[model samples]
Target: MQTALNNPAIIRFLKSKFKSAGFIDGLKIRYRSLICPFISLIKMVQPGDSVGDVGCGSGQFMLLVSEFATPSYVYGIEISERLVKNANELFSTLPRG
Candidate 1:
């Protein structure tokens, strides 16, 4: 899964989510929005490990962790109930590997 983060489709999926969530305006915000969580996930998570994310906006970063690594369980903590709801709704659409 080393190259998973580099896939255009993966990036697009994440970008769309952020856009849909009104978290970003366009491609200008994509790199900063995506890379921060990508780096955090890569540096901190491991396959089959349980993971938790605080301030997990839209839960996209948690989803990225699942894609970039095979976490056994994933949970997110968000201050916004709306974002948590949206994230859960979006997460249901992701293909499980």
Candidate 2:
């Protein structure tokens, strides 16, 4: 099976999710997604599972889950209101299942 990281379309979609963000924030989000073991974490997510990410900066991991997995519910908490706002905006652009 092709992992989300290896799938160009998935990567493109993920990048597009951050297009409205500031350049530095977009870069940071992409960089964190690249460096973190999100793929491994993603693999553990079962379909219809409830996922939670604490300190989810811009909710990148949650976005990944929404794209790569079918979670019943996703919750994220961030200390930064700015990041939370950014995450909510990005999430709003996601296609409804």
Candidate 3:
């Protein structure tokens, strides 16, 4: 399947979501997405699944879950206030279903 990492539009959108992030942080997000097996992780989510993620930095995994799955609920916990804030901002941009 064509994951977000393979899709330019998705990658662009992800990067754009981090516009307020520092340059190094944005780069780190991009790099993490490329290396993580997000596709496999996404595939594990079934429709109506209530997903939870630990250490979900910037909510990237949760973001992909929103994109690729019809989960009833998604939650993410990150220690960094900055990352959690960024995750909230990014999620706010997603269209409500």
Candidate 4:
């Protein structure tokens, strides 16, 4: 996972801590826009569905899906090291089951 933090230049830009509030709010709205479809597809996501999210900026959607769905594993490939670090930190603090 640490290998995700290798792009020093790109990481610097993404690490500037721009207001994620707007981004966060927009994310919720985007989910709302597609909730109906997502609900319909819920049954299609098998236990081992390898859902790959390309251009997954901050990985918020992956976390959201995990709350309701269980697969063999959830693997996200992100290009931004800054977001990777942030995700790592957030998940690290999650209580282990």
RMSD to the true structure for each prediction, in A, is: 3.7, 3.1, 3.3, 12.0
TM-score for model 4? 0.50
Clashing pairs counted in every model: 0, 0, 0, 0
Assess each prediction's global lDDT (C-alpha) against the native.
0.68, 0.75, 0.76, 0.49
Kindly report which residue stretches of model 2 are placed more than 4 angstroms away from their true locations once superposed. Answer: 1-10, 95-97
Question: Residue 47 deviation, candidate 3, in Å?
Answer: 0.9
Q: What value does the lDDT take at residue 90 in candidate 3?
A: 78
Tens digit of lDDT per residue, candidate 1, span 1-97?
3544554646675666656444444553366544554664455776678988899877766876776677788889998989889788868877654
- Between prediction 2 and prediction 4, which has the larger TM-score? 2
lDDT of 4 by residue, 22-86 (tens): 77645554444244344444345566676655665566545444443554555567789998886
Off by over 4 Å in 3: 1-10, 95-97
The better candidate by lDDT, 3 or 4, is 3
Give per-model TM-scores: 0.67, 0.76, 0.71, 0.50
Better of 2 and 3 by TM-score: 2
Q: Between prediction 1 and prediction 4, which has the larger lDDT?
A: 1
Query: What is the alpha-carbon RMSD of candidate 4 to the true structure?
Result: 12.0
- Candidate 1 residue 74 C-alpha distance from true site, Å: 0.7
Point out the higher-scoring one by TM-score: 1 or 2. 2
